[model samples]
Target: MPGGGAGARRRGRPRKDEPALTERVVLDAGVRLLARDGLDAVTMRGLAAELGVRAASLYRYVRNKDELLDALADEQFAGIDLTRYVQDDWRAALTAMATALRRHLLARRDAARLIAGRFTTGPHSLRNIEALLTVLRGAGLSDHDAAFAAYTCVTSLFGFVAAEQNRLSAEVAAGMAPREYLDRLAGRLRAMPADRYPNVVALAGELTAPDLAARFDFAMARLLAGIDALVAAGEPR
Candidate 1:
């Protein structure tokens, strides 16, 4: 009877040799699921299975899926190397940061979508914001301008990356090469009534520019130029 009860206990409970289920372990597993599969694959049960634990166990760390997603977004931010974006020139530093962030978001499946609309309070997220603010302030921006610039840059990054990912996925889903899709789109734009839409008919190709990276660079350059003008104007007296 004693041996039978011990065997039953062992069957129902986790083995002593199994790894402990900590927040970091759960978050790491979630990252793996998100990267390997996608945002949809990061359910509590799925993550628990990935970590060899029960679904209920994950609640010890995260309250729900939304909390898990917020944590995962923070994890992605944590993975970014802020030092890599550091530069003596503010424009160069911000450019590097934006470029690095785009690449980072694209590296994982649905990473950009996962981060969109979530305001994480994790240390990594805070550090990233602090770093951006520091860069803007160092560039001689007024406090108001610095805050505005930081918000603008972050929102632009997320929106741009999300759109980029969605476009790529759409192309893949439609079974068309990206260039082919762009060409088709350009054709449609060019066929518009010239009198009604002169610019759309005239510059369809440019409108559907194939080089998103170059476009992103152009955008950042324009943003920096505007900031530079503000700096030249000197804080509003």
Candidate 2:
């Protein structure tokens, strides 16, 4: 019994070698739970359990579920590549930012779901926002238009990514291939009588095309074109 201390081991207590729980550790566990299970599975109690800690301990780092979600949303912004944001070309800068944001959101499960509901002001989020505003201002946008463009870009990203995720999830749950699912959708649209739904019948294939990248680029091109027109018009501040 020289090295053994069997009697000293207590139930439900951390081992002497256990790492201390910090906010970052808690957030990491929360993200893992979200990715492995989904958004609804990331409650305080569940996260505590995932970390093998008491539920009350999590409160020391994150007071509640809302704070956790906000922190997580901010954390997702950490992965964006700000270096690629071109300063001289506002359109290029914005397009790069938007594309990077979309990629980051879609990389994690339910990332957009939580981010859409939370307004994060963490350092990473603020840095990205600052970059966006700078580009807008450099493009000769008024303060109001800069604000509007920033909000519009972020909201559009959230909406489009959320829709893409939902569609992918639905396809997975239905046990169908992506192309098969789109084909089925196209068929359903084409089935409607041409007399009643001429446009829909005529463009069913185009409507249900699975080219999300092309569609997203087209949408952003149109939005940026409108903003470009506003800049050209020299709208009053």
Candidate 3:
């Protein structure tokens, strides 16, 4: 009767206050270590210590460090709404995807760096790509052009987010203020002899001008817009 359906007993529910066990804990601990100290600190042992469990216990949930890292990478994409996102107007859809990606990466600034360059073919990433492909096709792009456009936009988003995250570090934040840094650079350029460098000295402010956020937005948006236009006007078959 112990293992039989006739008189088998169901497993008891855990007490309300009882701590449940799962890969969630493992992954959450990995994320915390990753966010606090970057990817290098996220060994299985380190994650176990962070979770207050034996290092060997992690094997029950994750097979190895690679699996944990994959889980951590997948966590970043957990915030995206693929169904809603892939359903919008092509340009609007692309913008939404980029914005969502930026927000997700910005939240766990360290996590962004870890997962950016790894072979990113997880379900979420593929779904996003498939959506991008579909949108490009809808906008009258050839297969090659669609793929290239998707690569451009996705990579640009990742690069922008990574650069922003790097600069947003506490050290950079506490060090030279961006505006002051730009002002100092402006001064340096102004000090240059106009006779030697007329063009640079004449446009000192233009050279050192720092409209970082707006400038970044303008650049990313323009790049995507350009790709959209080009893909929409794909070469003849």
Q: What tens-digit string does per-residue lDDT give for candidate 2 at 1-237?
A: 011133322223444544578657887898789889988898988987898877766555666677777877777777885655857988888888888888888888888887885667788877878888888889999898889887888888898898888755477577888788889889989999999999999999999898999999998998899889879987866
Model 2 CA deviation exceeding 4 Å by range: 1-19, 168-171
- Clash numbers, per candidate: 0, 0, 0
TM-scores for every candidate against the unseen true structure: 0.82, 0.86, 0.71
Candidate no. 2 TM-score: 0.86
Better of 2 and 3 by TM-score: 2
Q: Which pairs clash in model 2?
A: none
For model 1, what is the alpha-carbon lDDT of residue 47? Answer: 82
Model 1 earns a TM-score of: 0.82
Give lDDT tens digits, candidate 1, residues 1-237.
Answer: 001222232323444655686667777888899988888888978887898877665565666677788888888887786656666699889988888888988887788889887777888887888888878888888899888888888888888888887755466577888888888889999999999999999999898888988889888888889889978877753
Clashing pairs in 3: none
TM-score ranking, high to low:
2, 1, 3
Instruction: Evaluate all candidate structures by whole-model CA lDDT and list the values in order.
Output: 0.79, 0.79, 0.69
Candidate 3 minimal-lDDT segment of 10 residues:
1-10
Overlapping backbone residue pairs in candidate 2 total 0
Once superposed on the true structure, which residue ranges of model 1 sit more than 4 Å away at CA? 1-20, 168-171
Regarding TM-score, does 1 or 3 come out ahead? 1
* Worst 10-residue lDDT window, candidate 1: 1-10
